[model samples]
Target chain A: MAAVEIHQFAECITCHAWSPDQSMIAFCPNNTEVHIYKLLADKWEKVHVLYKHDQIISGIDWSVNSNKIVTVSHDRNSYVWSQEASEWVPTLVILRLNRAALCVQWSPKENKFAVGSGAKTVCICYYEQENNWWVSKLIRKKHNSSVTSVAWHPNNVLLATTSTDGKCRVFCTFIKGVDKRDLGEGSSNDLKFGEQIAQLDLSVTWAFGVRWSPSGNTLAYTGHNSMVYFIDDVESSPSAQTLALRDLPLRDILFLSERVVIGVGFDCNPMVFTADETGLWSFVRYLDERKVAPTSSKGSQFSEALGKLYGQSKQSTSNDTVEPSKFRGGAHANCITCIVLLRRSAATTVKRFSTSGLDGKIVIWELDNSIDIQQPGYR
Target chain B: MAEEGFLEVENLEAIITRIEQKSRKIESLLKQSKPVEALKTALEGSPLKTRDERCKSANWIVVHRAMMAIKDVDAMFSSLDPEYYDILMKYLYRGLATGDRPTCDQCLRIHEKLTERAGLGCILRSLADTVNTV
Candidate 1:
């Protein structure tokens, strides 16, 4: 089957989350409400609208193992929704922060989720069986700016957080009561929640996105200065490698294999970056580079000019965030805001990925090992 | 819309970098007596006569700078014809809208020179034609 697009509204898709089975899609339509859609007969039908927040919804994540959805908003609220009696019920996670919740993600174990907020904290929220409510413990005082993005290690004990403060820190979120003992390099007795395990200065600008490698040995993040950085596991000290891109700031990133990463943002296309065993990161190629049709140099550059005019004409009708179409070859006409890996196993490579953008598009790219994850390079 | 704003600002930065690089390339090409090649390089990202189409292109700013470079540049004998001022004007207005102080200043410089070289009569004729056609 070809890639399916679920267009909601122009410039309205803030972010989106997909269920483990890829049957359901939940996205914030640039508002307080989270709209859930189900794939029905090769088309998406709006099934449910999750509402509660009085402000714009910033992020949403669906835990594949738990079959639950968590959403954070600018209203300083975070809700974990579970379906009971065929209706989604909201369980309020008590994220008592001074400012808005910016982003959220579930851990690999589905036992907990992390909410990055404007209050300079990442609230690691977990289910308190005793109280029957989700409770949050703070990873406090580490970040000076609002935490923009967060990713959890496969071990479920460590978290990688990126903040607008120009710092990306790896913290050991090993709660004594909640987390079971796991034999790992950083999971020592001295390790505790909020303890900074390793920190890397990504750039002078904000680190907008971060992702842990499948092996949990490396961390990759995109900086607001249009740079992609990687933190590799080097015995006790992690090594930081930065590759500066010539494009706009990449808003998000995802790993296709251990070495290949796809970054998308203002460039309006997914740029592939790769690393070798030497830990040197470099820009490999762009996924979408629209080839101009070969034409005789005789007449009508006017049509090409008119085509450009017609393309730009739509930008003015949307909100302020809608950029003029730049990626002439990419699927998404605007900046891609979110990207998630579609995987069959935790240990192997991700065969597919999905991206949602300001163009109100949901794009899926399926990969073949020989074609997409090819390791050809200067190495 | 926050996402859009973020993309636009970052894109502006990216576009500026690209324009700076290409403008230098054009300048160098002209210095090497390769005006034809310089024009070709200038037209690389933005298609010829496709001024309005490149609003999202990093080449938009570069195209403007390239146009100005050729117009001001003494390429052996002839400068870029005054007929291309409309294309330059398109980006000039859009660049001004960005409120980039240095860029607007550059545009003003180009504008003064454009009026002077094209002469007030041709400028008025084109302006009247534009107004009438619109």
Candidate 2:
């Protein structure tokens, strides 16, 4: 079977997220409407129309239970929508600090969520005891530029965030001091704010996206000059060794599993890499070049112009991080901006993936062993 | 009701006449090399109500012209400028190689005529090779 499937066409799909249970696929098109397609029913449906944002929706993520979804927008507000009374309703409104909210994520085990805004701060909003729902408690503000992406560890204890400042930081949540009160009016402080566990300085220009591995041990992030850095022991080391892919400027990174790292380049191709036991990474699968129709005359003309501008020098520069072998083909009609992997069931052996690009189309690909399964556990 | 009906007809006629007069003025301006002012005036006259409407209209016009112009070979040749002829030829060759599509045949014939007239042999062999691999 083909590794990539053209799922649907003609909608400006900006971001997509698979439900935790992998029963439904949620995508935001042009940031105008949030579309939810149920996999079981094989039907297309609009779960919510978020007309609140004057700008496009930048990021979206499903809650741990898959009953709710958190969305952030260029409008600088992060919204939480819940499925209640057989209808989707807006539950929480996280007011950001006067900047566009670029990314958002929900904690793995708790009701809390994190929002990364265009400002230099990453806000951690958890359920307030008085309001009975999630609210913001602006945590670390050390980032110099806007925080572009944020990811929560699978254990729900560590939170990783990336920013335009080219730095990624992991923050652990713990009770600094808690306040206790008996039936009396007097109260005593018992819990205090927790300190940051570690800070990984990437020192790159712009860190676009970050993702924590399934095991919560490794964190992958995209930086300038088409480089992707995989920090295996993020908690132990304050610096991550960068693994750069030559000639492919990656815009996003998604960890399909523990060893398999999928980096979506600005050229709109998904390059798969597998890390061996010695920390050496191997170029595994190039999913983009397969099953693409021949380029049209107009496409050729565009390619010729582009080739002239960039030149036909395929040689890898020594300063380049990843070797030229890591570069993949089968480019999209436009830049591939976002990608999400959808696992059907824990028992199921195969996992399917989806990618959305600037061309306003979503392409879904099914990964199976029949088509060159390079990774060990994949087969 | 009769008075209102008369007023509506008069308003429609007046608007049509005003549009015709403006179009003539634009034609004269274009001929006189005042294309920027003429384009500005034409755009202002047909100002789109919303951003979506404007985008839809622009896409419709481009697609419509491309589809309609491709229907006749003579018309396509007449419309092609010297600078765009090579680009059009490459498109034609690409289209023909894409066999099983009738549009490809149409484009091939156009390229054949242009190449014959300009005495430029098929320069798209390398491009064809690259596309066939993908």
Candidate 3:
């Protein structure tokens, strides 16, 4: 893009989720307030504010239909917000054991969610048949440490969870009220429970983030020492291979497309990598490495010199080693905690991508093919 | 006596003026590459205690002016030399470990400059680990 315009800047943006339709972004600034901004009239404006959480909001996700939003917070509660009577209201509240809920995600096809928390528990709450809202189906997993992150597969039939114990587990969703006696004799009740589909042992002691690929066949997770591991053939072999990635402590990973992955590293650089079906990987670009002119006086000469240096280097490097100049500055005032990219139906155009950092600033970058990335002044 | 004190003040003013004029002449002489004359005059015409003091005074002015010209943390760091960056990193590491917010700011200033010279990839992950530990 020629220039990235800051649509809305918050002082304490804790978490944000984009609508599946790419028309709105719902954000929780800290834990108590949730704001929804609609992209209309050529700008983003607040459409809803949810003020129900009594503690800091720790996790947020949007439903597949974009009609509902789920949030979990340190208040040990998970809430579902739905559009009702032209306003957003808390349609459901699932109270868990008296422990802080760290993350929540909605199932792709069904109105179900998986909530992970500090209590070493993973609760699967679904919409009740009689009531219009949701109810908790608490599953007390035997995890030694707190669950750090959770994700529901696109099929809505599987859930992936990670913990500080350095293990990634995939669990199959079990239908509610299903009895073990109905299946067969000598069948264990644990089989009636969500089956642990797979588990991966990691070298690092902590798995801070975990995400399933869009195809639901592969998984990617990040942990200590800046390691990002990718598990392919999760369904067939139950074995995972570590994908070679640049050495940086990755904060979060998002599958932008089947082949392209976007990740934010602890070093504050947003990286785009492409992987083939065989698991061979290639680094596409480092978003923060894009050259831009210094906006101030003290480093103007240095910036110019750097730009010239890059230009000279670009000339000497082979075409395969060089990337398009369309990269923009991904600099943040503090450590980047999260990143989300929303693609339009065409997938060629990026509707909006946001990055929030420790400095409490959330920036929305709008991309258009018409804008040239080669302009040195475009930051 | 009061009259004697006034006479001493007048003499001091004259000495200051003379020093100022001589310093300007020395500056011109240095600019013209007359190093011998410039060094001799700077040494003999001024009452300054040592060359180190003169250098310190000059550095203070440079620092004050540089600070004034700077607009942000990035600007402040971009102007610093490599030596300052090294000192800054040491100070920042110490400050961050102590949980001193003021030291964090100071370190951040140095980091901003280093980030300008280098990319965020060079310093961010290490800094994050340090902060997290603190």
Residue B61 C-alpha lDDT in model 2: 32
- Evaluate model 1: give its lDDT: 0.72
Q: What are the runs in model 3 whose C-alpha is more than 4 Å off?
A: A2-5, A131-133, A177-191, A243-247, A290-331, A347-352, A365-379, B1-134
Give the TM-score of each candidate.
0.66, 0.60, 0.62
For model 1, how does the per-residue alpha-carbon lDDT over A1-379 read when each residue is reduced to its tens digit? 1133435443658899888888888999888898888889977888998888899999999989889999999999899999888789998877999899999999999998999999999999988888898989998878999999999888888888899887888888888678987554443446767888787864666778899888887889987656678888822677788775544578999987687888989766777787877767778766664322221121244446645654566665664224323333357778898998775655543367888888888888765555554644211
In the predicted model 3, the residue pairs found to clash are: A31-A56, A31-A57, A226-A249
Clashing pairs in 2: A176-A191, A176-A192, A177-A190, A177-A191, A177-A192, A178-A190, A178-A191, A226-A249, A244-A322
- Model 3 chain A TM-score equals 0.79
Estimate, for each residue in A1-379, the C-alpha lDDT of model 3 and write its tens digit.
Answer: 4225444357667778888787878887775888888878997788888888889898888876756888899998878887788787786576566789988887776467888888888888877766666778766765667788888776566678888777788776766542123323232223445677777776336676788777876788876545567777665576555543334567677776565666675655666656766766556555554434333334556667766766777778767234544343344545667777665567464535777766566666554322322223322
Q: What DockQ values do the models have?
A: 0.03, 0.01, 0.03
CAPRI quality level assigned to candidate 3 from its DockQ score: incorrect
Question: Root-mean-square deviation of each candidate, in angstroms?
Answer: 13.7, 19.6, 18.0
TM-score quality measure for candidate 3: 0.62
For candidate 1 chain A, the 10 contiguous residues with the lowest summed lDDT are A290-299
In terms of lDDT, which candidate is strongest?
1
TM-score between candidate 2 chain A and the true chain A: 0.78
Model 2's CAPRI class is incorrect
